[model samples]
Target: MSYLELEGLHLAYGNAPAVENLNLQAGEGELISLLGPSGCGKTTTMRAIAGLLAPRAGHIRLAGQDITQLPANRRDIGLVFQSYALFPHLTAFENVAFGLRLRRVPDASLRERVNEALRVVGLTEFAQRLPANMSGGQQQRVALARAFVIQPRLLLLDEPLSNLDAKLRVEMRSELRRLQRELGVTMLYVTHDQEEALALSDRIIVMRAGKIEQQGTPEDVYARPRTPFVADFMGWDNLLPAAQAPAAARARAPQATHFAWRPDAVNVGLGEHTGQVLARNYLGEYQEYLLGTPFGHIKAYAPVGAQWPEGHSVSFDLPAERAAPLMET
Candidate 1:
C-alpha cells in the first residue's frame, strides 16, 4: 500500500474551488513534487495534506490511517515553508528542539536528537547562532533540521529553497536531496520552479488550475509532454499545430494535433529551413536565438561559439525524432 494517499480530494476557499477530485499516492521514502504556477492549487494541495486547510470532501490516508479530519498538531507531519519560518529569538538548537520540547521528550534525548539533526544538515557549528545571524542557506538548514528532528511520518516542504540566490539554490537542492536520501523520509515538496522539481523529485505531479495536467518521471515529462500546456511548462519553446508543422514532424506523428520541441532540440547552422535571427542571447554555455521562421517565431539554442548576429540568415531543422507528439493544443 502507498504510504500516503489522497483520494477524490476536493478543496475550496469560500465558494471558489482550489483543487478538484485530486487523487495522488506516494510510496514510503518517495519524494513527490507538486509543480505548477502560482494559484494553480499546488500549494492548496500541500496545505490540505498538512492539515492547514480542511478539505471540502475526500479522504487522506497516511501510513494506513485516515487523517482527513486530524488536527495539524496531531497529524505527525513536519512542514518547512518558503520563509524558513524560524523564530527570530530562538537559537538554532532551540528552534530544532522546539517540537521535541512540545512532545515532552526528555532533555538528554532531545539534546542528542537535535544535535544529530543539525549534524545531518551540516549546521552543528551554527547551532547556537540566532536566525538573524545565519545566512539564508544556514537558516534553511536549521528549518530542515527542525523538521527532521521530529522524524514525522511525512514531510511537507512548500518552496523551501525559493528564497535563496541562484547559486545557493543549486547547492541547497543537492543538500536537500542528500538529506532526503540519508533519512529516507516520505516528502511532499511544493514548487512552481520546473528546474527545482526536475532536479529533486522522484516523480513530479504537474498541476493546472485545480487539477493534474500530468505526472511522471522527470525524463518522461520533460521529453514527452502529452498536452500543449505541459509542453510549454516543460520548456518546449517550439509548439506548432500539426497542420503548420514541418512535413517531417507531421509524418512522424500523424494523429497528433500539436507537436512540441525544446529550443535545444532544433538543429541550427545546417538544415532544410532558413530563418532570420531576430535576437541572440549569450547564455554562457549556449546561445539562445529568437528566429523568424516560415512557421512562426521559433526559439533555438546554438553553441556559444557559433555567434549569429541579429537579422542574419541561419539554417535550422525541426527534426521529427526530437518532436513530442501532443494530442491537445
Candidate 2:
C-alpha cells in the first residue's frame, strides 16, 4: 500500500462539489506536485489532506492508517501557504519554535530544534529578526523553517514561492528543492506554474475541474502529453494545424487533426520549409521568433545572435519524431 492515499475523495461547499472522486497515492519520501490552472481543485485537494476541509465522501489515509476521520490537529501534516503567514510580533526563532511550544517541549530541546531548522534553511543568522525586517526570500525561508521544525509526516506547500519576485522565486526554488532532498519528507505541492512543478516534482498530477487529466514524471508529461488541454496547459505553444504539418506527423497522430511542439523543439534555420519572420523578441540568452508558417503562426526560438531581419525569409523544420501527437478527436 502507498504511504499516503486519497481514494475517491470528494469535497463540496454546501450544494456544489469542489472536488469529485479524486484518487491519488504517494510512496514514502516522494515529492508529488498537483498542477493545474485556477479553480482546478489543486488547493482543494491539499486542504482535504491537511484536514482544513472535511471531504463529503471518500477516504484519506496516511502510512497505512485511516486518517479520514481525524481532526486537523491530529493529522501530523505541515503546511506552508502562498502567503508567508508569519506572526507579526514574533521573532524568527519564536515563529519557528511555535509548534514545539504548543506541545510543551522542554526549553532546551525547543531551542536546539529551532536552531537546527533555521540552519537547514540557511536562516540561522536571522533568528532574532521579525518578518518585516527580512527580504521576501528570507521571510519565505523562515516560513519553510517553521513548517519543517514540526517534523510532520507529510509536507504541503500551496504556491509557497508565489509571494516572491521572479528572481527570488528562482533562488527559493533551488533552496526548497535542496531542503526537501535532505529531509526526504513526503510532500504534496500545489501550483499553477508548470515550470515550477516540472523543476521540483518527482511526479506530477495534472488536474482539471477537480479530476486528474494525467499524471507522470516531468519528462513523460512534457514529451508525451495525452490531450490538447495537456499540451496547451503545459505551455507547448506551437500548435500546428494538421494540414500544414509534415505528412508523417499528420498520419501518426490520432484523428489527423492537430499537432504541437515546444518552441525549442522546432529548429529555426535554413531549410527547404520556409517561414516569414513576423516578429522577433530578443531575450538575454535566446530570442523568441514569431514566424508565419504554412501550419499557422508558429512560434520558434533561436539562440541569441541567430537573428533574422524583420519580414526576412527563414527556413525551419519541425522534426517528425519530436512532434508531440495531439488527441484532438
Candidate 3:
C-alpha cells in the first residue's frame, strides 16, 4: 500500500472549490512535490494533507489509517512553512523539543531527541540561539529540525526555502534533499519554482486550476509535456500553431493545436525556417534569442560562443522528432 494517500479529496472555501477530485499517493521514503503557479491549488492541497484545512469530501490515509477528519495536531504530520514559523521566545533547542515535550517524553529522552534533530540539520552548536539571530538559511534548518523532531508519519514542506535569498535557497534545498535521504522519511513538498520542484522531487504532480494537470518523473514531464499549458509551464516559450509550424513538425502532432519545441532544441545557423533576432541575452553558458518569426516572437537558445546580434537573420530548425505537441482540448 502507498505510505500516504489522498483519495478523491475535495477542498473548498465555502461555496467555491479550491481543489476538486484530487487523488495522490506516495511511497515510503519518497519525496513528491506539488508544483504550479499561485491559485493553482498546490498550497490548498498541501494544507488539506496537513489537516490545516479540512477537506470537504474524501479520505486521507497515512500508513493505512484514515486521517481525513483528524485535527492537525493529532494527525502526526509535520509541516514547515515558508516563513519558518519559529517561536521568538524559544531557543532553537527548545523549539525542536516542543512537540516531544507536549507528548510528555521524559527529560532524558527529550534531550536526546532534540539534540539528534539538531544534529541532523547541522544545528548542534547554535541550539541555544534565537531565530532572530540566525541567517535565513539557518532559520529554515531550525524549522526543518523542529518538524522532523516529532518523528511524524509524513513531512509536509510548504515553500520552505522560499524566504531565503537566491544563493541560500539553493544551498538549503540541497541540504534538505540530503537530510530527507538520510532520514528515510516520506515528504510532500510544495513549490511554485519549477526548477526547485524538478531538482528535489522523486516525482512531480503538476497542478492547475484545482486539478492534476500532469504527474511524472522530472524527465518525463519536461521532455513530453501533454498540453499547451503544460508545455508553456515547463518553459517551452515558442509554441507555433500547427498550421504555422513546419510541415514535418505539424505531421508529428496531428491532434495538437500547438506544436512546440524547447529553445535549446532550436539549431541555429542552419535550416529552412528563418527569423530576425529581435534581442539576445547572454547567459553564462547559452545565449537566449528573441527572434521575430512569421508566426510570432520565438525564443531560442544557442551556445554563448555563437553570438547573433540584433537584426541578424538566423536560420533555425525545429526537428520533427523533438516537437512537444500540445492540445488545449
TM-scores vs. true structure, each candidate: 0.97, 0.92, 0.97
Show the colliding residue pairs in model 1.
none
Number of clashes in model 2? 0
Clashes of each: 0, 0, 0
Q: Predict model 1's lDDT versus the native.
A: 0.94
- What tens digits encode model 1's per-residue C-alpha lDDT throughout 117-159? 9999998899899999999999999999999899999999999
* Each prediction's RMSD to truth: 1.3, 2.0, 1.2
* Candidate number of the best lDDT: 1
What's the lDDT for all of these models?
0.94, 0.90, 0.90
Per-residue C-alpha lDDT of model 2 across residues 30-142, encoded as one tens digit per residue: 99999999999998899999999999999999998999999999999999999999999999999999999998989999999999999999988999998999998889888
* TM-score, predicted candidate 1 vs. hidden true structure: 0.97
Residue range with the least summed lDDT across 10 consecutive positions in model 1 = 320-329
Q: How well does candidate 3 score on lDDT at residue 179? A: 96
